[model samples]
Structure formats: structure tokens, C-alpha cells
Target: MSCCTPGSSRGGNSSDAAAVPGPTWRQNTTATASGETVQVPVPLAAGEFDMGDNFGEGYPADGETPVHRVALSAFLVDPTAVTNGEFAAFVDATGYVTDAERYGSSAVFHLALDPSDTAICGWAAHARWWLEVRGACWHRPEGPRSDIEGRRDHPVVHVSHRDALAYCAWAGKRLLTEAEWEYAARGGHEARRYPWGDALAPAGVHQCNIWHGRFPVHNTLEDGYLTTAPAKSFHRNDYGLWSMVGNVWEWCADWFSPHYYRRSPQQDPRGAPFGMARVMRGGSYLCHDSYCHRYRVAARSSNTPNSSSGNLGFRCAADDSSLSFGDPAAPQ
Candidate 1:
């Protein structure tokens, strides 16, 4: 197990790094049945997009090895990860309580600078950058002291896969299949390391949000954010999807198997039939090239369905047939 382990969504230990603002992107809008306005998902036309890592760019695991091509049906995807305010609206409508709230705890990443802080979860054995906090939840991502006060627009975190599914269920949306996710994330590009291109920083400009400094110790905040940023903070992909490669790890609908790509169906390949963990993609703010290199377009990770953390969140997806542009169908 490496620092980029697949089980937890701890945002990485950069809480003290400070949150800086960045540019925003264009978006479409829609209203839910409950009259709550939300960002309309962009439509991705039916096409083929490359999936998985193949640049001989192997990471701590072989999950993303052997880059492959996949064909997908057209679908609609949220332009941004679900925001705190959005999730709160869902909660208000459905009275849903998140897994973190029920469990009374969620994994949180705290810097190892304070010896006392390390005593809680005793530093993750595989990734020393994470810690499990007692009161951490999506509403209080960093713990009780941390609230989504000014972060209404930021991606909602500390949500387990179940929590995300609940939101999707209420919204009449579903988690994107891994293939669909990779296709949408690729943004019509061909084998580029990131959603933008091969360059991590094109022309010395930061495109997405990821660690800008040393891993686990220092965060330079070069991208203008230490932790989660507004879902649309950075530039969007060619498909108009914002922060596709970072900010938070978006959950996928497939069960995770490192080698599942080997036998995955060529067209609209879904993951294994059943597994202990679901796929997570696009990495999080904690991602740094020095350790967790999962911020790439083809990188992959996973966590159990019940797992929750400060960096784990999700975006909603729906079949093209279901979306009606001006008004979406109510959840069944």
C-alpha cells in the first residue's frame, strides 16, 4: 500500500496550506422538480475515448496499465462535482443522513506537524498523510471545527459511495460507468496525460487543482488552493467539465479490479460484477507527482462503498435519453 492507497479519501495533509481563488468556467443551468436550481450537465456525444495508462507510466499499482480504447453511448454529466449547497438541498428535500453522520466519524487528513494529531489514527500505515477523525463528515469536512460556511460552492466531501448514490438517486442521476467517466474526462483528446494535455503546467500556467509543492509536508498552493476549490475554479475540459482531474476523487459505478481492463468489454465496458470497492478517479487536491500520481486522465483508485473522507465526492451522470434539457425527470 502506498500513499495513494485506494481505501480512503483523506484530502491529503494540506489544511494549513491556505485556500486561494482561481478563474471560473462557463456553465449551463437547470431547475430540479423541487424548484432548486442547479448546474446543467454537459452533453457528451457518442464516441470513443482512450482509457487507462499506457505511457509505460506505471504507478504504485497496475490498475491503470495497458491503456485501451472504449466506445460509449452519449450521456449527460454534471459540469462539476456536487457542491455542498447542492447536497444540502438534496438533504433538505429528502432528509437523508450521510454515512459519516451515521457512523459519527470519517477519515481526515491532518499534517503530521503536531504529535498529538498523529495520535488519533496513528498515521496511516501505508500513507502517512491520512488520519481518521471522530467527527468528520461531509457537512464538517475537516471535523467539527470545519464547516461548509463559505464553501457552499466547493465540492462536497467526506461522502461515502452510499451517500453519493443517495444524492444521485434523489436527483434521478447515476454514477458514471468507469468507461463513461474516462471518455468524458478525456474531453476528446488523444492519449494526453491530463485532461488538458501532456504538460502538467502548460506555459507555466496551472490548469487543474493539485498539490503544488512537496508531498505531505509543504503545499505551495501554486494553483491558488490548498484544499478543495470551487468545482468550477479551474479551466474546464473541452467538454466543459470543470476540475475533472483534481479537487476531489469522483466515484464511479463499477466495482474495482486492477486488472479488470484486461477482459473488460470493448464497448461501454463496465467493471467487475461484484467487488469490495468501487472505482474512484480524477484524484484529489492531495495528489502530487512525488507520491500519488493519480491526477492523470487514465489514473485509477478505489474505496469500499461505506468509506468516507475529506476528499471523496462525486458528480452525477445520466443517460442521454433521460435528460430533457429544460427539465429533468424526478427520481423514482
Candidate 2:
């Protein structure tokens, strides 16, 4: 696991397997009362763009170097991360279970926990800020006591890579490739530190959700968010995409390899063929420059496929043929 995010080490028990009876569940494409889907994907026309970090600001070990040109076919991506309410609809329809729920625990930031809920079963040795809290699933974000009653619009967390794939399958979408993710996140910008520009906060404005104070200790909430903000709280990029670099780390559809960039294909690179962990893009709300400064557009990280955390979530993407004018999940 990366130091920025903790990965789950526990395996699912027999009881966990028994809880979810089937291997696959029904897909939920239900429309709203007004006949609109929960999300509308944004389309990016086919083009070639510079991929990876040219500046030396990123961690070299994570393979953010050797900036290369990448050509990609047209694709559609979700404007924002998947919300708790949307995930709830899928669970309600298919009775699908998340990896965190299956494992009976997930990694949660220490600061997000309340003083009363002391059910921390484990901790990341290198980064003590992460706590393996029991019953920390999608609905119960912080733990058993915490619920998504008023946070339905917030991006859903505690979803593993497999769980994200399950959601994509049910929604008739797929996870974005690392190259595609960077392309959409760039939002037509070239070699810019962030989706907006080089400045972290231009003209004294908090553009996105990130740590505003001391790391894992004092979060002044200068950006008005200690945890995650609303999925669409901040301004969109040049391509009209929201929260592309912060709020939560998004899962990508590629196996992680720190050295992949050295041998990456120039045309729509799909990442490594096989690996121990998968790629995670965009930093989360816990990101602090003093510690994890991976909030940049080209920054990358990875974790085991079965691992999940409170600050980890994902969005979906699809090819042009899979989307239509009347498709609720497609771009309007």
C-alpha cells in the first residue's frame, strides 16, 4: 500500500461469502421522476496530449516522470465522483456488497473518527493517521455510528477496486484508464500543475477541497471542509469537470507500475498487464503539502485491489457507442 492510503490486509471469511449469495447482480438504470439519470458523463473528443509530470515537484518513486505524448480515442467520463445516494440505489436494486463490508472493516483517517467510537482494530505502521475501523462501509463512512443521512451528495468512499468495477458493471460504465483519467483531468490544459493552472489557489481562492492546516492534527477548515465537500462544490475545469484533483482519490482502470512510464505506449496506454496493486489518481481531502502532496493532476498512487479507505472513491467512464441521447447515464 502507498503511504498516502492504507490497504486492507484481512481476507473475507466464510460468513462474508455467505452474506452475498451470487457472483453477479442485476444492473440498476432507474431514472429520476423527471426522467433523468443520477449522473451525466462528459465527452472528450479524440486527440493527443502530453501525459505525466514535466516539473520535478512530484514524487519520483511513484513514476510521475518521463513526460510523454499520448493519443487517446474519444471517451465520456462522469462529471463528479459517484455519490452515496447513487451507490445506495445500486445496492437497493442488486443487493451487492462492498469489499469493505465483506471484509467487515476499512481504513479511515484518524481525525475523521469521533472520540466515542473506539472500535479501531488496526493501524498503518508507517502512517499512524489511518485507522482500520470495523463496520466502516459506504453507508457508514466513519464507522457504525456514522451514516450518510445528510451526505447523500458527497462522493461515496470505502469502495474497493473490485467494488468499483461492480458498480461500473451495474451502471453500464467502466473505470477510466490512467491515461484517460489524466486527459480528462487536464481539461485541455497542457503541462499545468493543476487542472486550473500552476497556482494552487489563484487570487486567494480555495479552488478545491484539500488540507488547509497541519497534517492529521489541525484542519482549520479554511476551505470549509474537514472531510469531503459536495461532489459539485467547486468550480469545473476548462472541460467542465468538477473536483478532478481533490476531494477523494479516484480509482483508475490500470494495474500500477512505478516504472510503467518508461515503457508506456504513446497511443492510449492501458498501463501494466498484471500487477499486485491498481492505480489511484487525484489526491483526497486529507492531502497536505507537509505530507502527501499528490493532489496534482499528474500525481499518482496505488493500493491492493481489495483495499479501501474513507478518502478513496471512484467515478465511471464509457465509450461513445455505450452512450445515447436518451441514456440517463450518458452525456446530455
Candidate 3:
């Protein structure tokens, strides 16, 4: 019943093993396909920026307060989330299976499912808007009846933290730390509610993709999307990054901690030492101001490592030293 991505039960089915099998699940050393030609990583210079919500516009319980200054080293970040095409290439190269696929099901938005299919799908007790559909994974986002088809450019969903890590390994990159993500997301403009500035729709134009109408009921599609949009759909931020705060939630390398900011280090703070769930930044298309107003740059949420939903996706990042200039194989 999380306002954003909901957590899923591990082990998939009752007969499945409690532990993730095979060496490819958690290891980042697995070699897969090259991510070059998919999307080039954008280089970001190291700098100090104020992190967190100082304006008190964020969810207090989610720990968006005690604005802290953080310094980050130069790094490379993907300009856009990993697209369906990019992920398919990795699967083809490594024959990897995602956690959702192993679980035999994943959480899908109720609106995305066919009316007939809802009768068969199980609904989450806390969040009726989410349907647990069998055969629902990254490839078949909605259910067994759905496919990516012409939406290859759309961000890949139903990917778990482990799945994202696997993609990062195959791409020769890594996930952005929570500090790095916030610093990059600000795009050098501190204290802004969004990457684009204080306005959600500056000049009456939608800068990012998010819910536009009543939540779990109707969608106005004002931003031109009911689900996910193209990975690079919107305009780039000051950092030349696209979709930094919307379209879908991007997974961070740090573990979740509601109180981490209070004790976070001044330099490159990575989050808590350990936790049950991982951090996910940038609200998804399901965010609405009336309910889940977490689309702001400083907002954050988390789910278990094994969790996956249609609104969840991720981008890659890497240390600057690991990438050469103009290297297409970089993080993106």
C-alpha cells in the first residue's frame, strides 16, 4: 500500500526456493551484452549541493528534512532510464531471468489491465489499484497478454533491485548512490522543488510525466501518458539529464533509511549501512499532488530488493575514472 511502488513477497511461489538461485542474481561480475548504442552516459562534475527538502514541501515521515550539504565525486550517469530494447539486448546476451519472472507474477496497475483480466488477477489488500498478475514481468508488463511491441523506447518496468544491478554489471556501470542521485538531480540549482525549477508546469507546459487526474480512478493524460513514456520523452535538465523526477522511479545504490540524513556524512553519503529495502528516487507516473506528491527532487521511497512493479525502473551510473570521454559504453 505504498504511495508509490509497493513491496512484493519473495520466493515467488510457495514451491520456489527461499534463496535466489544461480550466480547471476546478486553478483555484479556477470558479463552480459554491451550497453553501447543503447544510450550514452552523461558526465557530471563533482560539486557540493544542498540535499533534501528545506522548504518543508516533502513528506516528513519519509525523511526529506534536515537539509544537508553533500559533496559528490565526478561520475557518469545515464541520460535516460534503461529502455525495453536495451534490456532485451541484455537478456538476449546473458539469458538472465529477472526476479519478477522467477516469482511468476508482478504488481501491475489496475488501470493497465484489461477489464476481463482483473476478474482473474489478485488485488493487493492494502492497495486495490495494484493487481498481482501472473506472468507479468518486464517483457509482459501488464500480464501474459501484454507485450512491449512498439514501445521499445519506453523505460523497462518490473525490474527489481537485483535486476537493475545485473543490468549495471552487464553494461559496465553501476547504480547512482543516493547522494550522487540527489546532487545530479538538482542540476546545480539548489532548493528547487523540481529539476526544472519551482514550477511543476512552467509556462503551462508539462515538464515531466506524472498522474494528472484522480488517483486510482481516472487519468486525464495531461502529460500525454497513462503509463510510462519514452525514456527520453521530456526536455533535459540543466545537467543534461532527462526524466530525473518522473516517468518512473529510478533505483539508487543506497539502502533505505528515513533518518539517514540526520547523520549523513558531508562528503558522498551513501545511506545506511544496511536495511531490508533499497532506496528508489524520482516519483513514478502514478504520482499525483492530491495523494502521492513525491515527484519533487528531494523526495524518496523504498521497496524490498525483490519487489517490482510496472511503475518501477532504473538508470545506471559509474565512476568518472571508469569511463573515457565520448565512450558510448559508459553508464547510460
Candidate 4:
């Protein structure tokens, strides 16, 4: 986890690592039927967008291990992530209990030190994270101290894959498949490093709200944010999607297998037959070059679907035309 940044490229020297900006918020222009229910309105994201790397600015991880081609018809997607307000609405509407809430705690990065000692301090955790912190659920981001009263626009955190599944079921949408996610992220272009082209950071333009200067100890705020920013803080990709590379590790629908790419079909390969963990992509705001540079488009990561954290969240997706999930009569 410390060795990978969400969007870092290992090799394949790129001359255009400064072409496009990172994902920023896109407008929620699609209108929805008026309803008192707290529902996410998804829009038709039509056209066949390319998936996987072409410029060699991505990592070769399982699932993303192979650089394959896929042609997907247009679909609909939520303009932004599922927000605190939205999740609250879901919980209110249904007695759904998130895994984090049911377990009574979740993993937190334990920055252990003697406080008086400077020898064990570093951005990259010298040891393993996933410390079991009691009362560490989504509502209480910092263990009963934080609340979502003023963060309605921020993406919801500490939700499990099952929770996301429930939300999708109730909202008349579903989570984006890994291939679909990449296609939407790329807009219409072949993969470069990010949702944008081959640029890590464009000159004079701060793309994603990543960290700057010395991490942990010193933060320069070059991206106008020390922590996470509003969902719309940076520029959108060609597909008009925001923060596709960073902010949180979005959970995809596919089960993970590091060797899945080796057997990935070119048409619409989902993932392995079965696995314990699900795929997490786009890295997160915690991403740093000195640590996890996994924000790259082709990079793949896996985690227990039930685990949650401050640096993880998700969005929703819908279908375009009259079809959903390849079935013309699929329910919306």
C-alpha cells in the first residue's frame, strides 16, 4: 500500500504527462422524474469509450494485468459519488446496516509513535495499517467525533460492497463494472495514465487535489486541499467526470484475481470466477508518489468488500437507451 500511488506509472517514459487535467465534477444536467424519495439521478453516457492503456502510462495489475480492447454501448452514470445526504436517505428509507456499522469498527491508518520520539515517523507506514478502532464507522469518521451534518455533498465513506449493492438496488442503478468504469473514465480516448492524458500534473494547473511537499509532516497545499475536497474541485475528463483518479478508491463490480487479466476476454471480460476481495480503483486523496501511486487508469487493487475507511467511497451508474445490463427490457 505504501509503494503504490493511485496514478503512478512504473515505466514507459511519457512525454505527455502534462496533457490533460485530472477529473473534476461534471454537471448533473440529466433531469429525473420528480419523486420525494432520496434517489440518485443517473444520465445516459452514450458512445463507445475505450478501455485499458494505449500510451503505456498504466500499471499491469491483476484484472488490469492485460491491455485488452472492449467495446461497450452507451450507459448512464451518477454525476457524482453517493453523498452523505444520499446515504442517510437510503438508511432512513430502509433499515440497511453497513458492514462497518454491524462490525462496530473499521480499519484506520495507525500513525504510531511515542509522540516524544521522531525515529518512527514517516508518511509511509513502517508497519501494517488496518488497526481495529472501535466506534470507527462512517457516521463517526473519527470515532464518534465526526458527523455528516455539513458534508452532504461529500462522498459517503465506510460502506461495504453489499451496502453499495443495496443502494444500487433501491436507486434503480448499479455499480460500474471495471471495464465500464475505465471506459467512462477515459471518455473516448485510449488510456493514458489518468482520466486525462499522459500527465501526472500539468504545469500551472493542479489537476487532482493530491498532496504536495513532504507528506504527513509537511503539506504545501499546492492543490488547495490538505484533505479531501468538494466533489467538484478539479477539472473533468473528456467524459465530463470528476475526480476519477483520486479522492477515494471506488469499488467496482468485479471480483478480483491478480492473474485474471491473463484470461481476460477482449469483448467484456468481468473478472475471476470467484474471489474473497473486490477491485478498488482510482486510488484516493491519501495517494502520494512516496506511497500508493495507484491512481493510474490501468492499475488494479483489491480489498475485502466489507472493509471501509476515510479514504474510500463510491458512485452509481445507470443505463442508456432502453437497455440496462445488456437486456433491452432491463429495469431502470
Candidate 5:
């Protein structure tokens, strides 16, 4: 289920493999947030990297191939995924209700549907099962059965673009420009297939959250999370960022179009002028090669600004001088 598509770059055996070094696995220097929850500040190292992939590991519709170089200015990012507690704070401050709650329903994955069903959603309906349930939102992550009370550290999900935008505005931060996201996710490595390296099986260990067994019917859960994990559960990127891939799809500031990257400039390009959907980076826990696999660093996907579901969430980024990226006493 790798995301590679036609014309994407494939690793040249051991050449690309030998070229890049893995992440430093730095110790956590937690920065207590302004509230009760603690958030680590991810120090963003400024640099450039070849963006996108030409390998066979991306989705065709994802438009992540034809890899190109992109330059981004330095900016700080949250070291961990946005948590329920933080999002709750945003809600309290802004009184925001996500699109899912407003619309009273959102797209639910359904793998089998009548082909002639005029109401059938596009790719979202490709899943084995999905239902349009009311009250499904960030608070009620999986319709009526889920709640966020105990999982304050887990990345918030079922968030729409509107929700993310509200949180960003309240936090005095902005969504990472597409260039900034890809570069940061690459963890300062140039031409590495993933943030870690070319090999998907790095040191016989799974690098990120992805499906391990038969997609819908079975999951090995080898990485220890069936759905989402605490934002800092796994290893961090070189910049100390967590959950850059898999777990949840993060909303970006730019509107989405398939060819946006092709026409976009290499320097801090955002995205298209306007589209029905905004660009969403990273991939969700549900991504699988048998289905959607747009989780690569260069990978891209789009969802309507108003759409919210069980799989979508976001993180906030701030200016470099913000003192919030981690403890100043903490080693880089």
C-alpha cells in the first residue's frame, strides 16, 4: 500500500539510502503551555530541501510526485500535535463549533456503495464502512461513542478547516506554509525518502503510523496505536516535531488544486488562489496503500473548509523567536 505513483522518484538502491542520516532522537524538553497542559516547542531549523516525491509511494490524485526543491524561512512549530485540551481552550475563547456540528453530518467512509448512487462521496466513500452520523465532531470523535476527557495529550481529531483556522487565529499562530511543512517534516535531511531515510523499514522498525496488516479487516497495531496516540508517543523529527505523518490529517493555510505545486514557486509557495477545499498535510490514521496513502512528506490532500470527520486534526506554528518551542535550558 505504499503511496508511490507513476513518474515518482524511486530510491536508487543503496545510493539514496547511504546518503542521509537519521534523526537525533533528542530528549524531551517539555514547555508547559499557558494553560494546564504542557506543550513542547519544536525548534524549526531554517533550510531548503527537494520537495515532493517521484517515487511510487504516493497517490496518483495526491499530486506529490515530480519532486522539486523548496525553500522556507525559519519558523517555530508545536513539537506535539494539537491536543484536546488546547482545542477546548480555543472553543472557550472563540465559542467555535466545527462544521460537523453545524452541518449536523459529515462524510463517512463507505467502501461499498451503489455506483449509480448519486449521493456517494468520491474517495471518502472508498473505505470499507462509514456512516453520516450526527454529533460526530472533535468532542465526539467517533460519533456518540467517543469523548476527549481523558486523552488531553492525544492529538485532536474530527476537526475541520474552520476549526483549525479558529485555533490558529486564537493562538496567534498560522498554519505552516506548504513549503515550511514539507521541509520541517523532512527533518533537515535533503533527498531522504522519508523523514528518517529511504528504507520504509528502518532498522527493522516501522518509521511512522501506517497500516501493518490487511487494511480494513485487520491491523497488526505493531506501532502501538490503533487510532491516535499521545502526540509525543513516537520519535520526534530532527526539529523535535511529532506526528508529522499518520495519526491525523493537518489543515494548511492554502487552498488545494492538483497542479498547484507544479505552478508554485520553489520559495515558500502556499497554494492555489481558491478552491472548494483547503490543502491538508500529513495523512490520517486510516491511510493505507490499499486505499489512501498520501502520508509522505511531499504528500498533499484537500478537504472542504467546512468538512470535519474522525480523521482530521491540525497543529499550530509560530514565529521563531517565540520562546515556546521548548525550554531555553533544554539542549537542541
Candidate 6:
């Protein structure tokens, strides 16, 4: 299911009837991981790659129409979504308050909700599984009684797009542009459904953490998770980016536009000039083919800049100029 409520932008769409092969380029460098912050050194092919899903391969979303080509510049991105530990470090260093904290409330998944508090919480009118609770922030993802505890390695959720920007600014980085995000998520693959490939479970091996059994009810935990998994729990894509498809919905550095792809620039497109909701990509653990099949690499989503939820989080990216090129193996 979509992370944001209605009025948020939908996924990018395409008019192309078939998948287009991506341009080929020599790989300059691959990604590397460190203790907690895993930065991937992406050497983009830099020419053209199919940017949206064709009719039959992806879910039916009007925003995901008009399959088109988009070019992106080479950039460095975090291999994994920012973890709670990393966010905590940023908080400790800057004493910055997140939007969820400032607002004293956030949207939480119903499965993660406390049994007794269910009656008091408000549910999303469209997606009843989403519960709005006071005191639900990144640290207290499930609400007041919840804490990071052993989930330090898990992707930090309940972070608004503004909160993600603050973290990026503090780290001297920026959020990935929607094109950049799709490029990185594709992970050197061309027109594939996921970072790995078209098969959701290639060779019957679960590659990412996503919903199992059913959505909003009875998650069998067959993927070894009920909610969010550790940021690095799954196999990294060709670019060594982890959890690019499933885990949490990542915020992107672009405003929402249903037809942005129609008029988007051919070179390093920046997304809609201005809009109310910001772009978000990657389906979260709540995704199910029966409901939201947006976990596909080319799929897209969006939410208000200040909207925060248990399934929402982000990673950081830096321009190639921002990091030293001395050691390719060194983390950014």
C-alpha cells in the first residue's frame, strides 16, 4: 500500500509498450560498506535508462505511466538506508528535533501497534492498517512504549522528508534526486523489475524484506520479518546498495508531479519544479502484490514534506565532488 495518504503524487508512468535496454558504460567503481554508514560509490552509465514501468510488468498506477528515458550523473549514495544508530548519532551531535518529535505524533503501522492502544488511535481512512499515534517518532517508532533497543541496525522510520533533509544537511550530503534514486536502485541492471532482476524471488530466495502471507493482516514473517528489518539484512544489489526495494519507503529529493516524466529533462532531470508533496521511492515492508506492488525498482511514491510514518525513512547521497577519490574502498 502507498505510504502517504491521498493527494500525494502517484508513481511515474510510461507510454512505451516494451522495456528498453539501458546504455552500456564501463563501471568506474562499486560501493563499499563500513561500520554503520555504508556509502556506495556509483559510477552511473550517464546516458539513458528506461525510467518507468511498461503496462504488463508493473502495477497499475496512473503515475507510473509513459515509460521514458532519463539520464543521471555519477554520484555517491549510502549503500543502506540510514539506521537508528546513525540517526541517534546525528541527534546526539546536533540535538536536532525531528518533525515527528516536534509534532508529537506520527503514523504507525497497525501490526506494530500496542493491543490496548488500538482503540484510542486513529486509522487512515483509505488504509485502515495505518494508525496515527501521538508520541510516535523515529526513536519511539511503535509509540511511547517502543524504543530502538535492539533495532539500532534497522532502518530508522517515522522520519519526515524534512527530517531526512536535516540529517542530509548535517552530514553534508543531500537526498537523492528521483532519477538518481531510480538509477541507484536499478543497480546497474537494465529495465528489470527489482534491483536484482524481474523475479521477485529469483531461485526461490527472498532478496528483500517485504510483506509475506497478507498485508495489513497476518504477515507470516516468511521473509524473516514482521515489520522493518535491519538496514543490511538482505543482499546488496550490483551497486552494493542494500534494501533498495523493500524495507522502508525512501524519501527522494524532488517534488511530486504525475506528468513530470512527460516533460522531464533528458539530462539529470530534477523532477517537478514545485509541488506540495515530495517524492518517495521503494516499496516498504507493507507492500504486497495483492495491494501495493510498488517495491519494483522503477516504481515510485510520494508524501508531504512533513509526513512521517513507521514505514518511511531515507538514505543520504553526496556529489562525487564532495568525497575524496583517493581510496575507492574507503567509505564516504
Candidate number achieving the greatest TM-score relative to the actual structure: 2
Candidate 1 per-residue lDDT, tens place, 1-332, comes to: 23543364434321111222221212343554455458766778899866778576756454786667788888888888999988887877767777778767776776512345422544466765777676778888877666889998899998877787777766667899988888888889888888899999989998888887778778888888878898878688888888889888998998888889888887888899887788888998888878778898888888777777778799888888775555543211
lDDT of 6 at 27: 26
Residue pairs with backbone atoms closer than 3 Å in model 3 (clashes):
none
Give the TM-scores of the predictions, in the order they appear: 0.86, 0.91, 0.90, 0.76, 0.79, 0.86
Tens digits of lDDT, candidate 4, 43-67: 4444454455555544455445456
Where in model 5 is the C-alpha error above 4 Å? Answer: 1-35, 54-56, 107-125, 321-332
C-alpha positional error of residue 51 in candidate 6 after TM-score superposition, expressed in Å:
1.1
Which run of 10 residues does model 6 get worst, by summed lDDT? 14-23
Model 1 error, position 155 (Å)? 0.4
lDDT of 3 by residue, 232-265 (tens): 8878888788899889999899889899999999
* C-alpha lDDT values of all predictions: 0.76, 0.84, 0.83, 0.61, 0.64, 0.75
For lDDT, the strongest prediction is: 2
Cand. 2 Cα-lDDT: 0.84
Arrange candidates by lDDT, highest first: which order? 2, 3, 1, 6, 5, 4
User: How many clashing pairs in candidate 5?
Assistant: 14
C-alpha positional error of residue 38 in candidate 2 after TM-score superposition, expressed in Å: 1.7
Candidate 1 has which clashing residue pairs, if any? none
Tens digits of lDDT, candidate 2, 211-230: 98878789999899988888
To one decimal, what is the Cα RMSD in angstroms of model 4 from the true structure? 10.1
For TM-score, candidate 1 versus 5, the one ahead is: 1
What local lDDT does model 5 show for residue 249? 78
The segments of candidate 3 whose C-alpha lies over 4 angstroms from its true place after superposition are: 11-36, 118-120, 326-332
The TM-score measured for candidate 6 stands at 0.86
